[model samples]
Target: MKHFYKAMIGLDLTEMDDILIKKTIVYLDFLGIEKCYFVHVAKDLAVPDEILRNHPELLAPGDESIEALIKNKLREFDFPASMDIEVSAEEGSHPLDTFLRWAKIKDVDLIIMGRKEELAGTGSLAKGVATKAPCSVLLLQEKRPPGLPKKIMIPSDFSDHTDLIYDFGERISKEMGAELVPVHLYEVPQGYSKTGKTFEEFSEIMKKNAQDDFNRFIQKFNHNGLTCRFILNDGEGQGKALLEEAKLIEADMILLGSRGRTKSAAILLGSVAEKVVLANNILPMLIFKKKGETMGFFEALFKV
Candidate 1:
């Protein structure tokens, strides 16, 4: 079964666009992506009057030039003839709004974009789309090597969210022949000694309890014959611990589940997911969201 049939890729006209497009092609088969929409949104597409006067040879409209440029960049890649590809260069005061609108209009199942690290970018656009897009978002780090992931790390709290995370992980693992490493971070309570146990003993007990919870959770899904790792938080935050574990295991991709936001909440993404998205600059991260789960909320929020 295909998880992502259609995807929208956000391009900033920076070098990152090359990385994003290349990675998308690499994972197109693994993701079961049949169609891709390459979209670039600028704050203002109109060329400045001074620059236009200085260079009268540039007569084409701003959007048309950008669209042509993107098309030319894509021509360098030999995409499958069966793939449906389209490019759009648009103007919007807020690029995020334009991205979300185009994503909804196209009914994309996933949004692919890049996260800047060594590159000269704040990565705010990637974060905004990951948090607010109606579909799942794949963030490719600017410095990371572009290819299919060998090991996919998933952080599980053993909640309903874990189910979603595992579902995606298993699908990707099966399709791409990657290994699934489910990681669960457990913490001992501050007052564990009150239970008449030493800190070390309590830590072991907490670990055991986490293992038990994981076993129960895993029973619900097939998991493609994989195991879950139980780690002690050791005072660090969950987000930090997750990244550390990903490094220790040499995971190339991090799969996370976003609980999304309610109508009253100010933020759309959960705090842990946001932290991971911001701090992670080495690994490609896939922030999965159940399609249409928050469509009503987004439509109202964006006034669609």
Candidate 2:
């Protein structure tokens, strides 16, 4: 349950709120983050040349930068003596690109930000960063708990990535003294009855297989002081099912494995991670692409 020392937090000016900053602070404290950077990219703000000449008051004073404003808000929270903070505000046509560049330049271990529903020019920057960023990315929507999350939900399909997701959830749960809930959803595909088995029979077999996998997954972890539980749900549409389960258990956060699906697979069947991120904007989601499973150039360029 070691902490992420260096972190970068991205801020959306339009969605700025005290709660988001407060949550960032809580996460920093929870992780014992040593150094933190806050960054905000101001979208295109075109003003007429005539207005600038006549209306001088329209522009902020020299000392009143957006980064300064965000830093002032962050002052409301209590940071540890060991932690240092920095802030940046930039204007760019591509906010996502700006965020990635800053993150790479800084070599941050974690990137935090709020999820945007839909902006005119930027179409889900959170999704883009989650998919392409070198380090782990955390995307939070509004209305999270004031403090560190108490219960975290992790989705699993029993792939090689499942163990990584579970390990992350376990670390967070142990560090924050939260509960880790692993959810696995399964459903039989259509036309499976052609195998001569009833739909109910097929479903039962699939559920059994999922349960066995879930059991095997848990056996690998040592749940010494952690409260870990497994949830086996029956249905298709992993994103929808995950949302329903999170609500059912009242989960405060979600941990997912990035690069969980291929581009063609996502297009044909719809990606679970993308759907959940898009559908559940209120919950905080941490997406991690495992160390060796990096995305290729074309995939990073055009996948989202």
Candidate 1 RMSD to the real structure: 3.2
Candidate 2's residue-wise lDDT over 1-304, tens digit each? 3446788887764444455676776677566678888887655534335634654554664224455556656765554446688887776788777777787678777888776444333437767777667677777666555567888887767665566667777777777888887777777867888999987798888887887776665566543343334444455456777888899899988888764455322211127776777667767887765433443432454446
RMSD of 2: 5.2
| TM-score of structure candidate 1 | 0.88
Off by over 4 Å in 2: 43-64, 76-82, 116-123, 219-236, 260-270, 291-304
* TM-score for predicted model 2 compared with the true structure: 0.78
lDDT of 1 by residue, 1-304 (tens): 4789999999987788888778788888878899999998889887657646755665788977767767777887765668899989888898898889899899899999998888788888898888778888999888787788899998777875667778777877887788999888888898887889998999999999888877777776655376888888888777788899999999999998776334333226677777778778779999888876757766787763
What is the TM-score of each predicted model, taking all chains together?
A: 0.88, 0.78
Output the number of the lDDT-best candidate. 1
The best candidate in terms of TM-score: 1
